[model samples]
Target: MDFFEVINNRKTTNGPFDPRPISKEHQRILMESASRAPSHFNSQPWRFILIEDAKKRAAIADLAGRSMEKLIADGLFFERYRPYFRFSEKELEERGDGIHFDQLPGPLKPFAKQIMSPTGVEIMRRMGVPKMLGRDNRDLVAGSPLIMGVMLDKAEYIPGKLSGFYSIFGMGAAMENIWLTTHALGMGIQFISTPMEIPENWQQMIALLGVPDNLELMAVYRLGYVKEAQRRPSIDWSSRHRKRLSQYVFRDSCDTPESDDL
Candidate 1:
């Protein structure tokens, strides 16, 4: 498919992937395509770790289950509360982390709940992932037919602040590459970040991937041949166009022409 077409058609696949194995040549091609993704300062901070071992996949799934349990125990399963159940501003204030749950408009409540829920963890367990970390190991000690790992070099800034935020952007670029390459090769890929359940252990997860001390886990993707391609729901472009360009664009002065383009 053409590059632009691939971009337009690409969609996240959640159903079971084809159980067939992907070839090394194809894997290499996909990785190369992913590496072409743009990065800030050409830092090229992304790294990949692929998991193919059944046993290891199970272990990863177990970890995910435990993570979900932890979140549920902590009363962090926000998905349980829909718009039908509302919390007062005082209650939201007490649960503060700058997360103003009560302040979210009614229509956006479902989205807010998904963001704060342990959905990722639950999904991982449901998928039956095994290894906590590793790529394509047929044996306990050595190689496998296919599996890869992706990592990101950590920035020296605090999370969500300044340079640190760019790390995610760079990682996202690489991720896009991975998806495109895999799809073009007629293979499937799944990116898992739920294992990094405890944000505090983010560094530890990076270490497990054998990345440099300063690096962090960006994603863990699984690859395999897919028997059939999954279908994506059609998007409602009309809703996206609800707002006019003027709502977001601004001129130096209101008196100035919006622009010939406008």
Candidate 2:
């Protein structure tokens, strides 16, 4: 596919990916392409750990489950993740950021919107609905054919300085390279976020993965062959998508916003 088409067509797949393993050649091509991303002062900080072992993936899922339990016990899961769920039909129609109710599974779409309100959450909890059900990501993390643990090389970045900030910026660029490359390859990928909600859970992942102490794990992404996407009922994502170009692209000067092709 052309670069522009690949960029616009890439989608985050949250459902079960095809169980077939991606080829090693394709994996290397993607990683090598990501590594070629420009970095500040040529400081390449991005590192990756590919988990192909079924047992290890299962272990990560177990860790995610524990984290979900902790988040609910602390009453922080639904509360902290409100930004991800669109609460009402109006918000879903208007907002460009975050996941919409229509993006959720058909059965959960109604309840998924309820996470937007505290009263809604409390009512669900009182009704014996498991809080973990709302945040469960074990299947996404473990069931995929490949899991990538992204890290930053501490030695490549200067601590407590502009270099640290630059490293983060560089990491994003690198990840974008990988993300776009995945779409170009006929594969799918999505970030695994549940484990990072708690410090202890992430720490356990670091230890279990045997990641070097000098590296900081920033993200986990699942990869596999593309499967048929499940679209929600009565929702047209093509028409109600991201923000307009005017909301971002500024002209030569901040005040003279529309002077050029914004």
Candidate 3:
């Protein structure tokens, strides 16, 4: 793929990774592209722990499940993130952001809408739906051939300072490099955020991964082959998946239109 083609074609491939191990050459290229991302003060604060062991992957997946179960048991899982979840097709249409049901499997559509209502969630809890969902998450994460733990080393970044912002910006650039490179290699990458959203879960994940105290895990993601062409959610695709360049870009001064060069 060419430069812009790679950028435009990249999409999250969480649902249908084919469970194939990435090639040695591709893995090398993956890390190289990540390292090449620009960093503040040339201080590459990011560190990665790549997991290929099946048993370890299973354990990590199970830990994620358990962490989720704990959250559900505490009766706060949905309560915490419910506001952030855009449930119905109506909500997606209005906001044009957040997870849409089209991004989920066809089977999960009704549940996605139902869970937003307090009564619906209470009913699911009584029926052990969250437990089942957590169990399913194990299979979900374990199915991936490569599990990447993206971390930031505190010592390498200037914490509590403007440099810290630069470090994070650099880390996002690195992840994008990884995403684009993975797509170019005919593979897919899906960011996993269940752990990062909850503090207890995030700590559990850190311990399960054996990451030392010196490094803070910023995010986790899975990588593998896609079984088929990934579907672009209609709500997102309707607008070509981004804001109009005019909405964010501008001309020479403040309120002017962008020039033709854009």
TM, every model: 0.57, 0.84, 0.81
- In candidate 2, the residue pairs with backbone N, CA or C atoms under 3 Å apart (3 or more residues apart, or in different chains) clash, namely none
lDDT of 3 by residue, 95-177 (tens): 55555434434554567666556775676677776787577566678888999999888876567788778889999999999
Off by over 4 Å in 1: 72-75, 79-148, 155-163, 200-208, 229-262
Q: In candidate 1, what are the lDDT values of residues 182-234, reduced to their tens digit? A: 67766655544445656754444454455666656555655665556443211
| Weakest ten-residue segment in model 1 by summed lDDT | 233-242
Per-residue lDDT for 73-128 in model 2, tens only?
Answer: 55586687656666566775466565554544345556765644676656556643
Model 2 stretches with alpha carbons more than 4 Å out: 72-74, 88-93, 102-114, 126-136, 229-240, 259-262
Kindly indicate the candidate among 1 and 2 with the higher TM-score: 2
Name the candidate that leads on lDDT. 3
Error of 3 at 226 (Å): 1.5
lDDT for 77 in candidate 2 is 66
In model 3, residue pairs whose N, Cα or C atoms come closer than 3 Å (at least 3 residues apart or on different chains), thus clashing, are none
lDDT scores of the candidates, listed in order: 0.51, 0.73, 0.74
How many residue pairs collide in each prediction? 24, 0, 0
How much is 260 displaced in model 3, in angstroms? 12
